[model samples]
Target: MKQVVAVTSKAQLEAFIDFPHDLYENDPCYVPELFIAQRDLLTPGKHPFHDHSPVQLFLAYDNGKVAGRIAAIFNKNHNAFNNTTDGFFGFFDCVNDKEISSMLFSKAEQWLKEQGATSIVGPANFSTNETCGLLVKGFDTPPFAMMPYNKAYYESLIGNVGLHKKVDLIAYRFGEDGYDDKSVRLKEAIVNRLKTKGIVIRPVVKKNFQAEVDKIREVYNSAWDRNLGFVPMTHKEFDYLAKDLKMILDTDFCLVAEKDGKLVGFALAIPDINQILINIRRGRLLPFGLFKLLFGMKKINGIRVIALGVVEGYRKLGIEACLYASIIEAYRKKKYKHCEASWILEHNELMNKALEHVKGVPHKRYRIFEKAI
Candidate 1:
């Protein structure tokens, strides 16, 4: 018989974190997340999200062996900001059995309902601010950095459990001979024109990193306020994330636009470190894993533009295209093999059009599912 149990012990939590490694042992496209990072994110004291919200982890067992795992999350800030009583389930992984999957979902839903949540929505690890969504398409290629990947049967498994599609997040790919370069070709002219208007485009200054991060945080919060499910990240939360991103950040792909010394927009792309993590043997960083990360960085040839936005008042000034053009131009000089700009909302026509204008092909589609509690 299959049974669902709330994760309470440290041993059970480790089992929960390691379950996917065992399940996808032979799957080439499955990249094991770094053990320490996942542990830190889920632990209350280690992550800032837990400061304002609560999350419970659950694991399903079949005859003493792990069958599935999920997290039932209550984001106090998300609910308060959006004025809705919605709970979330994230960090979901499971076997192919429908019964186990259903049991897990039932447990999550029961907890959410008891928490007074009227609806449950996710696959979101915590919130839309973090890694979320189930891979409904583009399973052929491994995920880029910070993107989610799952079994092809997940769509049916989730649907069978009563969760229906809420929104589709698109991932676009720009690779060798694939990117639209009209923007890049006109980059010089674009910058020159904007310069005449007192807007200067430049690379982020690593020397003043903290100050720059603070400014970018402002732009980030303001730029994305109107986006679907977007709740402004708390100060501690943004700082925590910025600290992590600083490790792999490249100045060439991190650009900013300033007019009269006010930060108006920014774009950030990081080298696709998944290439190294995929070889890290269960996401360990000791006993030669660190060496692989250090040595492997030099050989990585792909980048993921994870964040790019301009403040509302600055939107139509061609800053968006210039940012995309600048990143593409940097990619060309670096001779990178691939680039991905991801998790774009399907209904975001303006941003979607900007990407399509640059020959970015929408290659992957991920879905966020919701069910009434």
Candidate 2:
């Protein structure tokens, strides 16, 4: 018999967080997320998202043994922004059993239904702004930082339960020696031309990060408005994310294009810290794990270009090309071996073309699934 139980105690929640470690213990490519980070994000008072939204976690047990876990999320900001009442399921992991999968989805759907949600969609740890999507292709390598990964059989498991494809997110890879250098070669000329309009490209000012983040926030909120499933992040939410990324942010790859000191565009890439986290048993940062993370930063050989955007009025000014080229140039200078520009909406032709022009190979595809509640 299988039963789904809502996480109500600290011990149960801890078990929920640790389930994947045990599930994928033998999978060499599996990378466990940091236990502390996951704990804080799941706790109501610890993360700012909980202030305006509701998320419920669940655990499934077959008799006395754990079988799966899922999070039922009601993102108020997302609903209000997109004008749709949709709930989401994230942090989803389960054994290869149809009965257990159905039980988990049933529990999540019932919770969302009571919340007045008309539809449920995801695998989105929390929201699309965070780590979302289920890997449907490319199971050979581990995911880059902040990306999601799962067994190839997950597609059938979720599909059998009635979640249909909503959209596919693409991940492109650029090897250190394989990318087209045209963008890099043209970057200098583009910057010179932008200078005629009082625009200039510069790296992020680490000493003045708060001020820089404020400027970039405006552009970020406006630029990605049209993207699929995007919702403008609240001030508190963006600040929280900025603080988290600041720890791994390298100024060399965090560039901004400014017109008289007003940020109109930006791009940010982070070291593939998953290389280090993959070895941290059960995602614990204990006596030895802390040391591995501290010294692993210098050994990472890849970067994940997590974000790149330009405000509406600044689009088509070659800012996007310049930002990407600048990063590639930096990648070469630093001798990083690989880079992944990812989670791009499949319908985003302009950005997709730009990456294709750079010889980026479309290596992985992730799908977001939806089902009416």
Candidate 3:
């Protein structure tokens, strides 16, 4: 028998978090996300997201054995920001069974309908500001830091529940020999040119970290404002995320474009800590996992160019290429094996071309889906 139930208590919530740990146990490519982080994100008062939105979690069972889990989310900030009553389904995981997937969506739909949603859209863990989209391609490799991964049948399962593709997010991979170094070669020249225009590209100042975050937040909100479904992250939300990433942040990998000593653009690449997390069973850091994390992080050989953007007035100023070049130069110095520049909008012509210029290979594709509720 297949059954679905709302996650109402701590035990049920723990099961909800741990379900994938069981489901993907045998999969070699699966990386366990941190338990404490997942717990905090799902808990109301622990994450800043809960301050502005409501989310309901559900778990499905087959013959009393856990089968799947999902979260139905209504983002007040997303709706108010985008002016759309679109409910989101995220943290979705399941067996290959089609019926259970349908039931999970049905429960999500029921709750979303009560909340006045007109369309169901996602695999957005919460929102586009965070990890969103279902992995429609690239199941052969583990995901980079902060990226979602899933089974090959996920596309069909979600489609069966009436959500069809809305957009595809693209991830590109680069390696030492494979990537073009034209941007890196021209970096110094580009920086000099931008210097003449009063814009300089340099590493992020760790000493003024909070102030630096505020400036980058300004650029982030402004730069990505026109993206599809993008909502400006609240101050607290960005800070919360920054505080976490600070542990893995390398100043060399974090570069900024400044004009008149104010941030005009920024690019940040964090060590691909997933490289270590993949070996940590069930994402636990207690017991022996803590030592692994502490020591293993220094040995991580890859990075994710997670964010790169320039505010409107600063566009077409070679700032973008310079940012990429600077990061690439840093990567070469560190002797890293690979870098994943990811979750780029498929139709973002200029950004796509920039990566393509550097011979970035599109190795993975993720999709956002939607259905009228």
**TM of each candidate vs. truth:** 0.98, 0.99, 0.98
Rank order (by TM-score, best first): 2, 3, 1
Q: In model 2, which regions exceed 4 Å deviation?
A: none
lDDT per residue for candidate 2 within 1-373, as digits (tens), equals: 6799999999999999999999998998999999999999999999999999999999999987899999999999999999999999999999999899899999999999999899999989788889999999999999999999997888898999899999999999989798988878898899999999999989999999999989988989998997888888888889999999999989999999999979999999999999999999999999689999999999999999999998888889988889988998899999999899997999899889888987989999999999898
RMSD to the hidden true structure, all candidates: 1.0, 0.8, 0.9
What would the per-residue lDDT of candidate 3 be over residues 1-373, giving only the tens digit for each residue?
9999999999999999999999988998899989999999999999999999999999999999999999999998999988899999999999999999999999999999999999999989899988998888888989999999898888989988888889999999988678998888888888899989999888888889999999999999999998999999999999999999898899999989999988999999999999999988898998989999999987999999999999988898899889888888889899999899997999999889878888999999999999999
Span of ten consecutive residues with least summed lDDT in model 2: 226-235
- Taken over the whole model, the C-alpha lDDT of each candidate is 0.92, 0.93, 0.92
Which digits, one per residue and each the tens of the lDDT, describe model 1 over residues 95-200?
9999999999999999998888999999898999999999999999999999999999978989998889999999999887798888888888888999998999
Candidate 1 TM-score, true structure as reference: 0.98
Model 3, position 4, has a per-residue lDDT of: 98
* Clashes, model 3: 0
